[model samples]
Target: MAPPFAGGEEDEEARWCGLSTDMMEMILKHLPIADHISVSIACKSWRLATSDIILPALRAPWLLGSPMASTSLSWGFYTSSNGGQSLGLEIPTEFQRQWCCGSSKGWLMHLREPRNHSQYYEAHLLNPITGATVELPPFPPTVIKGVISTSPFATDFMLAALCFESTNFDKYVIVYQPRHPRRKKILIDNAMDIMFHHGRLYILTDLAELLVGVFDPRWKVSFKSIPTLFEEEGRHPDTYWGKLVESNDGVFVVYCTITTGAERQQLKVFKIKEWGRHHRIVEVKSLGDRTFFVGPFSDGVSISKMKSSSKLNIIKPDHIYYITGSEYSLWAHCMQKRHTFRVEEFKMTGNILEWFIPKLEDRSNLMVVTPTHSTSLLLTIIIVMLAVIGQCLLGWLSI
Candidate 1:
């Protein structure tokens, strides 16, 4: 009788199965976020190796549109780089009916229906890539505007929501995950937008002053004011929209001006610099290699080193992609080139357009595998080869 490992085929199989866990992990880290879950289920050793591996950032932001009224399984996505290629994704039925309120850190905050129709609906954070959901406390039925969090995966996270009561013209900012039963609330008369950055919460008011709130060790909130560079521009407040963004350098406040009937729009960016004890706003004439994507619901910006690469068509550095309030039309304004282009291929009608970033979570599709599976090894090898080819193509195009 032949030995169990005598054949060349068996030897080859054993060699592949004997790959070190660390080696497997290093290889998997280079793959995209979408392939993480699929590769984790390949085999026992591969599954254990990728259990804690971090994924690389592969693609830029894709515009996620609302599902069509006819089909609950399909959602639309537009790639800005590929000349606005329209792609449809099949999502779960539960997400089809819900309304997307906000998105951050690769998670979408949706207003889901209540278990019982009599009860009030609650908001839940869903990672559309991994199908993981985190339930949040119930919110009021009024127009809840803001939802920003430091990170959804962290143990100690700060979440803030701005609820607007149109009847009484009251606006309240609710800070969540408090020790006591009642969360902290701050009342502002005309707070327009709220953003959280670097352990501080910023509120942009109608007076063009940035309100800075810092939570103490005991979670008590204190407020201060920072002078803005917009005051020096002498532009009308009604013509511009302000948003807070974090970049590689530091925090920046961007003001985008789009008049009702004007043909040209302007974007003014300021960097928040700290002196001895005061925060000074410095105006920047160029964005370098960073592009800002601003929307009504959520605002996000992306930075890329390969500005002239054909693969990076969806987003270019030193540009701004903004959505109009009434028409919901998407437009890209190049800061350096001083030109404007419309992303009319998507044609979003309603106020549901949002920028979505992709991420992979380990808790969702992790499963124990056994060594009896040999087919999984083939699939993993194929996937790894494809990923390598894709990366090479991207690098070649970048040159």
Candidate 2:
């Protein structure tokens, strides 16, 4: 009996469809992280291959907007690659009324307010993609300024937060672990920003000092000052903000300065140099294809080739993309061009805009495939393939 659509054409189709699993995996590995879930659903073998595959570490940064209201469980993601379109992500119910303190390595630190006066506030880490949550111990009622972690997925990773004891001036840092009595507090003068780089923690102070802390084998933290990067110019005209970032080249401190009522913003990058007792910070004019994304929670530098396009809209190489407290307005300071511009595409109404890096990991529950999103991704891939095929066919006919 002959089956429907079974002919010489069917044999050719079958042969074409029988691509080796290894070949399919290699192809999938080169695709963007957004398309992984869609490709996995194409067949059983592809799904298995995706399950075993480890994605590349390079990814572009997405802007994560705050949840609309206390009742809303959805947050908006503004992707520059998609022409700055905002995508709505439905978070878990536990995050419905919480405040997002910080985000690092695909994890968000959220503080849940107490339902009543008798209960204390609780903080937890959430992976919005996988809807997995891990609760920390009760936190003091202080205001949380920022949070950073040494890879949230690891068992021994340390979670630290910069907090203010009161509205006046008392500031401190708290480190959290997964075990009981989960927090340790450290008093510091004043910290403007905190960052984790290469198993050590770096803190920037308002007085323009850089402090580095290292943990001993017994887990005791020892703090030391890095060489003075800047000298006080006795009442400078411009206000400065400092951020510590880790790039492929080395650790850098980015200082952004804006003169009062001036449209242009200035950026300075300094590389850290250490040779035994000699420590120095050298100013550099070029960032070498690295673009930094700076915010209150975390500051990160992304290489040019890692992004979808060499230039991310107005965000060019050697530029720093940042948001100010003035209604969460977006701005970029270009080191190469020596100019600053406002990114008007970001129609922000509130203050909770932060840079988010989407990670595709093997263990995260957030990787569960959603049918609708995967379908849209599949359609996009198909259209791209069709366009390529059309171009090839035209070329072949001409030849």
Candidate 3:
């Protein structure tokens, strides 16, 4: 692509500047993430196209400050896209004093003690990269971790979590839905992890059971036990760590196990397939274009079906980045090839590290600009004004 001011005929100029936004997006879709800035600089139309195409693309998750780096105040994270580089971001001063209890997909859930005389703590979702926050209702101290459904500013925003404040098997899952004055609770017990998938809440329990929660006119969570893989197949329960992840193939429970070796390269992955009451755990070799990130502090987030053009090439396809309960280190492993990359020095508080995806700047607050070119639109406007002036002069002279 030549510079915008390169010598060109009218036809060449038209060809470069006349492309419609849709056509520009089609071309930009094929280009790598690195070429987007160049395309955006080519012309106003391409800049519009770049904003349309890139805003919704998959963003790389941030490696939240290891727990050791975190004190009671002020949290930090690494972008990890630039081979572990820093992106300037601000964690609100108030949040610095709060606890970051939950994090996922560009949002962090913080719990703060009430400034007023209230019994319950206040919880809210904060997007550090965007400096936007959604005010949440007061929550009891029993709340553990939270998962935000979408952007906190979105119309359909919802928050769900596993709580300890409730009695066992009763109201263990708490949900804060849009347009609701108070939160809702679900009845489930021993929930190890909670995830929202296909418009339903899935809870994994310590006993290798699944609780599917549906919020219809009322909240109902159905339970199922799938232990044939561990009980019948003789796979030791202590040998693996499990979490639920969504894929193009559907939701599956990923059981990851680290084998004993000097290289520590062996990582096995398996999925659970259920039909009525019969459930079979199947070995999975590949995760396709999907990638999963799991840690002790947040729900397993699978950022899947990504475009090849994203700067997040560091996140390998079909690979899972996991942290076992006993191990504080992070490991990225491929199911089929068993290729592994381990980084062991991340000393987080309680050895916990949460994955965070940074949100773009608040679009509602950004100043929108109308594109104008001095050699194009501006010149045309000047010519039209000059013509109007000439016509008025001729009429005045005749009068």
Name model 1 segments beyond 4 Å from true.
1-37, 40-57, 67-78, 86-91, 115-120, 143-146, 178-180, 306-312, 325-327, 344-351, 361-365, 368-399
Report the C-alpha lDDT of model 3 over 258-358, residue by residue, as the tens digit: 46742464554556576876656676778777787777657676677644333545556688786544445566777667777664433332434567765
Q: State which candidate, 1 or 3, has the greater lDDT.
A: 1
Report the alpha-carbon TM-score of model 1 versus the true structure: 0.75
Go through the candidates in order and give each one's C-alpha lDDT. 0.64, 0.64, 0.61
Candidate 3's C-alpha lDDT? Answer: 0.61
Candidate 1 clash pair list: 80-314, 81-313, 81-314
lDDT of 1 by residue, 94-189 (tens): 776776767666677777666777445687777766567777777655535545555565656666776777588788787776344566878987
Predicted structure 3: clash tally = 6
Better of 1 and 3 by TM-score: 1
Regions of candidate 2 where Cα sits further than 4 Å from its true position: 1-58, 67-73, 116-120, 141-143, 179-182, 232-238, 306-312, 345-351, 366-399
